[model samples]
Target: MSPSAVVNKRAVVVEPETTGHKNVKTKSVLLHRHIHYEPSTVVAAKGNYVELNSGQKILDATGGAAVSCLGHGNQRVKEAINRQLDQVAYCASLFFGSSAGEALAKELVDGTNGQMARAYIVCSGSEAMEATMKLARQYFLECAPAQPERVNFIARKESYHGTTLGGLSMSGHVGRRALFEPMLLGNVSRVSACNAYRGMKEGESTKEYVARLAQELDDEFVRLGPQTVCAFVAEPVVGAALGCVPAVPGYFQAMKAVCDKYGALLVFDEVMSGMGRSGTLHAWEQEGVVPDIETIGKGLGGGYAAVAGLLIGHRVIHVLDKGTGAFSHGHTYQGHPVACAAALEVQRIVREEGLVENARRMGEVLEKQLKERLSSHPNVGDIRGRGLFWGIELVRDKATKEPFDPKDGIAMALHEKGLEPKHSISLYPGTGTVDGKSGDHIMLAPAYNTTEADITLIVDRTTAAIEDFFAQRSYH
Candidate 1:
């Protein structure tokens, strides 16, 4: 590869990729996050290890935003995609449906054990969220009595839905929404998140906290006019936006009660925390509340294919079934046959191999290791999550719970250092920009099939990375 090369007879500037995203290093014709950053080049990958062209092997801990559940180069899924290609690869979703798509959708619906009535497969998490947002509006119109005024959406602060305009409007993530504030839909209002570390009053008990949070949601609905509210969108276990914060005991039940009282739909955005990443097949199952409309991605296809889906509850399906008899939204690539086949194969393995149980069991080991090692660190403020999903909040002063100054760039530094040659382990990190909070957070979302030994290696390398980051900062 030269600094300037042309395949299509055009000039191109080639530069190394940024180490900011897992030691990426390469020159390519793609628009990366930062124009001057270069990351390592991945030559190959097997199981949980990714190989770089420079011969460095990296332990994949975060699974690339918690995707890649089946790990790298899964032969079964590869064969499934190849088989689908031999038959039919692409088909217009609006005009026809393939057995591949139908089979995958049936599997998803059956996985819910009939709780979810229909499945609409899409290409990515953002698109799934964008679809669900539109579907909610359409659903109301198709209801027995059309409620056109039901446009207001209530979402919690410190939550992320997606990056598209509609998804951005529903999300409370600070940085991503700043650039499009003027253009984002203003119908979504935010309330306090169910984060116990930040939201709990000094003397409040768990029961009291639940009640207070529920009251806050009810109040928001009332303020917005109950009949005007469309839905309350949230991640059962908040994802990158809040760094894997799981709502406390009785949290979802309480929230659902509020939604029921107001006749607003309850939507769970399980893109990051669903599909066995959090031990259970669906994170909402653990919360004891089923969403009216659920959006899932990332782990859904396990990075074997581009796939995400919307799971509609029985009520929503019935309403639409009785009315217009069709959903008025879709993408060009909706229900792509090859993608569905790949996802279906990936899911089959996840179920047959018992990876969900492994995630639950290994999650205990992973969490215990993190707490035992870092809970006493001066900068460590909190450790909270469920199953394989965990997050560590880094504060400058644990006593005061004060976050490090934003200019310190602590989160990205910790992330980059963890992926260095010595560490050779990939991790996830969050700043105030992504999480809508004033602190640094590091997320550990390893593959669902990870072992005790893998967990141990991750913890050891990560602890060293944290210590090194702080020590180097002290020297400065």
Candidate 2:
């Protein structure tokens, strides 16, 4: 039970059979990710672990896409959901206002200290992103002088907004966008991402790298015509693509400055890195620049419910307030009471227990543990992140920064191996990281309430699983 005892334990090095490529047969009724796949059926979950029907207890390392910030099966959140279910579980936002919805929105807006004036709750991050895009169009039309010429948006390359058509159109995630390109809108364009690991040029200072990225944004706006741009959108700390990459210092400020010069809004997609992921309630808080419109998800409800919201900055809210006094969009479940109540209590626990601060403190511990254990490894090209959200990029050649061939399927291999009987540790896998088509990495986003034991165990399990993987690989 002692902290030092926990940290000092020898790592459980899972064996090399963690390759996970048996071409196993399946009787699966559900079409899980792959064709007729039969993965371990998780029948129960508690705390940071899920139990399979085969009696395997897997450590929930990535929090199921970083959604279980409060950890699994939280009794308090369950109780809150029960309370809301008793009162009113469902109410159309178009017709009636639920107290849970209003109170949660008020609490969320209050957390922003009035930087954001309104909250438009939705069922998912993709929906919230679609809303942000649609609202941006309405905003320009409703602005003074009614500039209809503002029809284009500039988002960063390798960034992920969401999976819906509008969201896909706004996103430049090559892997995610490839299949949907034909159906996507053509108004959005992209510039370089603000990743210093691979983006920074040879012998370039951080200042020069940021300056060049800023210039790229400026050029993109110029190419699109300044008057035609409606907004410049990016994730403050990128998720999925490029693997937990945060912009260089002053990066957001510089990008915001360009948006300001072009009379365009600055949008931050915090769907994966917000709500206490990066040691702050909002990742933008650490960057020192507020976004004109921000979309948040994943941790918003702590996975207690499918919930996401658009946090409208004062500028955008003020424009809508003056012009329409009503948003032109709404869903049947725009502000579901049960979902709102779950998120509200989850956030309340976060605030009362000081979990965001815990994220900051524990993040340092996790980062240290990961680097100490994996940084010197040949394939671990880089280790980078903040708060509890971290990533380990795998490469074929470390010195040249050459990534493994996509056919190697390294990230997914580790992903599957982590779930093998001996390891039984869940990890988040990402592909097409270097260019949206050829990079491999494993993301680690644990709970904000993760304990020292959880951190140590995560690091240990991750080390074991990865080591088990590379041992059998002939990546030459």
Candidate 3:
């Protein structure tokens, strides 16, 4: 098939026509996320590009949901994994502790400036959230006063935590929760997210808006009977749910105050925003607050392994250490040696190479380039983010900030268009940015080590993809 045909087909897998491989056209048995659209088969990935079987080398702008912080194929991480494998690939966390896990945990705790006392490593963001919920509940149970009645959790509307039942219960993403609402925990409730673009009223000062939000949170606690609340969960920088929206200055601080007043734990879900993706090592650092319980993932292993972790602050640690002296949770692969090794090395490289500083410097360039090139587009409603993480919200009417109909699939269409040979770029697309079901946004989270020239190429391709996507459609 020609490149044009491949582009027209939209995520169809292209079969090789070599004499030996001609008859290899077999239906895929592995259940893919999108059943109808067979994604292009990736042959190899290195640096910032993924080469597909169709001979297309696509630039990875979002790093596969912002996971690849170091980009792909880092020799240091590879060697670390190999070294861990040589010693032990997996160890039952309950029975034994591995050196890799110990080093990684120490690294994470140290990174937090000793503010966090312990680290519980897990396999994915969802698992980390699950562990976080269990740990928070346990902390309350083991507290000196033993507040077992503190069972409720409060999260923001239009936010995402994870896919697990506990995490999903805390999440406010409408589309993801629609089918599983019956199965979700009833104790969790939601308040408004800190979205200045939509939530801030006309002529409202940032201070006033923050005060209003804090009062809203305080009211929710009152409505739920503040004593019943266990935690107030939130992402320091909103990820896919709101399209990389950062909290307004002083927003998190106010929320933390409310949490403190109510004696509820403040849980920061940094699964997407942590690990230097947001310029700062921790997103909460910028907000001038430290969470009681924090989850870190995505960039932790830099796509070298499936890894995420929970960082426990001194308060939670003190309670747990004084009471049960044990966490009431365990996963079969809680601290997989290889994953820990990869993550430890990735963190080392991040610190040694000063990739965090690089992300901060490059983020400015990315932000400037994006605003200059695409901010004036008729369909571009808003551009917001920090560090290597950025998001572009698309709308039907820029004047009114009207999003396109959900059926239009505008964000995913832009994503697919970007993967076509002409564009050869990968963008992370998301819907439900405005509410939980009515907006479209594409996120860009390049690797931490991305160069200025890389930013130029990413912006060029991103601008072209957005332009070409809207150019082919009519609004009327």
Best by lDDT: 3
**After superposition, candidate 2 runs with Cα above 4 Å error:** 1-31
For residues 1-476, could you state the per-residue lDDT of candidate 2 as single tens digits? Answer: 00000000122111111222345567767654344334556699898998877788888888888788998999999999999999998987777999999999998999898899899999898999889988998999999979899999999888888877898788877766665678999999999998889888889998888788889999999998999999999989888777788888999998998899989999999989999999899999999999989999888899899899999988888888899888898898889999999999999999999999999999999999999999988899999998999999999988999998776667877888888877878888877789887888888888999988889999999999998889978763
Taken over the whole model, the C-alpha lDDT of each candidate is: 0.83, 0.85, 0.87
Q: Which ten residues in a row have the lowest lDDT in candidate 2?
A: 1-10
Superposition TM-score, candidate 3 onto the true structure: 0.94
Q: For residues 296-316, could you state the per-residue lDDT of candidate 1 as single tens digits?
A: 898889888889989999989
Candidates ranked, most accurate by lDDT first: 3, 2, 1
Ranking by TM-score: 3, 2, 1
Residue 316 C-alpha lDDT in model 1: 91
| TM-score of each model, paired residue for residue | 0.94, 0.94, 0.94
Question: Residue-wise lDDT of candidate 3 within 308-385, one digit each (tens)?
Answer: 999999999999889989999999999999999999999999999999999999999999999999999999999999
| Model 3 lDDT on a 0 to 1 scale | 0.87
Compute the lDDT of residue 281 as modeled in candidate 3: 93
Q: Where is model 3 poorest over a 10-residue stretch in terms of lDDT?
A: 1-10
